[model samples]
Target: MTRLVVLSLCIGMVSAASVMSAASAAGPAPSGTAGMLFNHEHLNNGSPGWNETGVRLNYTLAPRHAFELAVARTERFDLRDRQLSALYVAPLSRELTGSLEANASSTHRVLARNAFGTTLQYEFAPAWLVHGGVKTTRYDTVRVNQALLMLEHYFSNFSWAVAWRPAHAFGTNANSAEVRASYYYGDKNTIGVILAGGKEAANIGNAVTLTDLRSAAVVGRHWLNREWALNYGIGSTRQGDFYVRNGMTLGVQYAF
Candidate 1:
C-alpha cells in the first residue's frame, strides 16, 4: 500500500506539469548580492516527532555567479543530527549554467557522511528551465548514488517547479520527487503549496532503516518591510508505519 501511494504521487506531479502554473516555497530569495534566511520545521510521522532548525546565507560574486552556505540541526526522538553544505553557481553562457555542491553531516548513530554533486541547467525557451544533476554520498562504509532531473517555468503571476530523484543504496533502489507552485500578489505576499515523498533508505546511528516518507502542505510568506519577512506552513507526513499529524513550519528572512 505504501509503495502504491508513493508511485501515484510521483505520477501526479508529472502529469500536473501539463496544466499547472508558478515559483516554489516562498519563491527564490529576492535576487541580491547578500541575504540570510532562518527556517524552522516540525514533523511527526506517527513517531516521536522531530524538529529541524536551519540557516542559509547567499552571496552573488558577479553576474550569473553565486555562492551559498547552509547549516541545519535536527532534533530526533533520542538524538540530534547536524549538517553543513556549500554550493557554487556559475553561468557558462546566456542560456546555460552549472552548480557544484559539497555537504557533510553527522549524527549520534552515523558518525559522519559526505556528499559531492554537480548540476547543469539550460534555458531552452523563454521562461522555461531544465536541470539535471548527479550526487555521490559516502558514509562510514556505505555509498549512495543519486541522479536528479527538474523542470521550472515562470508565469506572470506564479511559478512552478518539479524534481525527480532516484537513489541507490545498500544494493537497493528508491525514488523521490518534489513539486512546488507559488503565486505572488500584493506588494510582497506569496502563497504556495509543496509536496515531497517517496520510499528510501536512511542511516541512523549506524543502522539502516527502510522508510516510507511522505508529506504535503500549503505555505505562505508575507513581507513586512524591505528587510523583514515572515513565512509559515502546515503539513503532515507518514514515516514508516507511524503518522505525523499537524506538522508546522515557520521562518523569517532578512535581505540587505
Candidate 2:
C-alpha cells in the first residue's frame, strides 16, 4: 500500500508537470499593457499538495516591446519544486510578433531543468491569428524538444483559442491539445473555461507504459475598481487510474 501511494504521487506530479511545461512554453498574453499578479492553488487527489504563492509581473515598455517575470513553487508530500522564468516580446512587423523565454527549475536539492524557447505569432485578420514555436530543455544529461502551434479568434466581447503541442523527452514522447473560451462583460469582468488533455509515457523502474491525462476548469474574474481585480477557479484532473486530482485557484491582480 505504501509503495502504491508513492507511485501514484509520482504519476500525479508528472501529469501536472506535462501541462505546466506546455502552457508555459508559448502562450498568448492578455489585454492590459502592464500588471502584477498573485496566485495560489490547493490540490488534493493523488496526494495532498498545494502550490506556494506565485508572483508574476508584466510591463510593456513601448508599443513594440514588453517584458515579464514569474516565480512559483509546488509542494508534494515533503518535497518542493521551485521554478522561475522570464519572457520578452517584440513586434517583428505590424502583423507579426516574436517572443523569447527562459526558465529554470529546482526540485528538492537538485537542479531539474534549464529551458529556452522562441515563438512567433501572425495576425491574419482583426479577429483571427496563428502562432508556432519551438522549445528546448536540458534535464541533466537528457535533452527535451517541443513544438507548439495555436489558433485564436476574438470578437468584440468573446475569445476562443486552441493549441496542439508535441514533445520528446527522456526517450519518450508526449502530445497535448487544449481549448479555451472566455466572454467579457462590463469592460473588465470576464468568465472562462478550459479543457485540456494528453498522453505521455511513464517509465517506472524498468517498465515503460503510456498514461492518459484529462483536466478541465471554469474560471472567473471581477474588478473591484479600475486597478484591483479578483480571480478564482476550480478544476479536476485524471491521470489514468493512478489517481484523481481536484484543485482550486485564487488570484489577485493590479493593473497599472
Candidate 3:
C-alpha cells in the first residue's frame, strides 16, 4: 500500500529538470519579455528527507538573447541552505547557440560552495544537434570537474537525445549516461521520459564521493492559457550503498 501511494503520486508530479529546462529549451522570449516561475519539491526515503522551494525570473533583452536569475531554499537532514544561480543564453550564429551559468550556496554543508558551466549547441544537420559542455564545482571537501557530450534529433513532433557525462572528484573518475524522449503537442507544451544510469560524483554532507546511480523520471509541461503553464516531474533514484530516493516536483510559470 505504501508503494502504491508513492507510485500514484509520482505519476501526477513533474521532474526537477523538466521544470527548470523547459523554458530554456523553448528559446528566448520576445524582446522586453519577462517571466517568473515558482517551484517546490519533496523527496522521501522511508523518513522525511528533503524539501525545496525555488523561484526564477527571466528577461529577454533582444531576439535570441536572454538571462535568468534564480534562488532556492533547501532543507535536508536537518540542514538548511540557500542557493543563488544566474544563466545567460544567446545565439552565436544561425546554427549555433551558447549558454553560461553560475551558482553559489549560502552554506556548503549540503551543497556546493560555487559552480560554473558553459555549453554550446550546434545544428550540424537538419533536425539534428550536437551539444558539449564542461563544469567545475567547489565543495567543502573536494572539487569536482565534469563534462558532457550529447546528440539529439527531432522528427515530426517527437525528439530523442542521448548524452554522456563524465566527472572526476576525490581522485576518482565516474561516468554516467542518459537517454531522453520527448513529445511536443503545442507551443511550449511537452512531455518526456528520461532514463539514466552509471557512476556519479556527488556532494553529500560536506563530503564529495563517487557512487553508482540509477534513475528514471517522467516530466512534462502543459500550457494553461497564453501566459500560464504547469510543469511537473516524478522520479526515483538509487545510490549504491547510500539511499533510495523517491521524489516529485511541481512548478508554475507565468509570462508578461
Every model's TM-score: 0.76, 0.76, 0.84
Give candidate 3 regions above 4 Å deviation: 1-47
Error of 1 at 223 (Å): 1.6
Best by TM-score: 3
TM-score, candidate 3, is: 0.84
Model 3 residue 103 CA deviation (Å) reads: 0.2
| Superposition-based RMSD of candidate 2 using all C-alpha atoms, in angstroms | 9.0
TM-score of 2: 0.76
Candidate 2 Cα outliers beyond 4 Å, as residue runs: 1-46, 107-112, 140-142, 200-210
Range of the 10 consecutive residues with the lowest summed lDDT in candidate 2: 1-10
Candidate 1 vs candidate 2: which has greater lDDT? 1
Pairs with backbone N, CA or C atoms under 3 Å apart (clashes), candidate 2: none
Q: Output the better candidate (1/3) by lDDT.
A: 3
- Tens-digit lDDT track of model 3 for 1-256: 0000011122211112221233234444433323333333344444447777777777766544567787888776678899998878787887777888898998867878998988887778876777788888898777888887888777877878787888888788888888888887866577778788888766454466787888888877777987777777778877676677777777777767
Candidate 1: 10-residue stretch with minimal lDDT: 1-10
Residue 56 in candidate 2 has what lDDT? 70
lDDT of each: 0.61, 0.60, 0.66
TM-score winner between candidates 2 and 3: 3
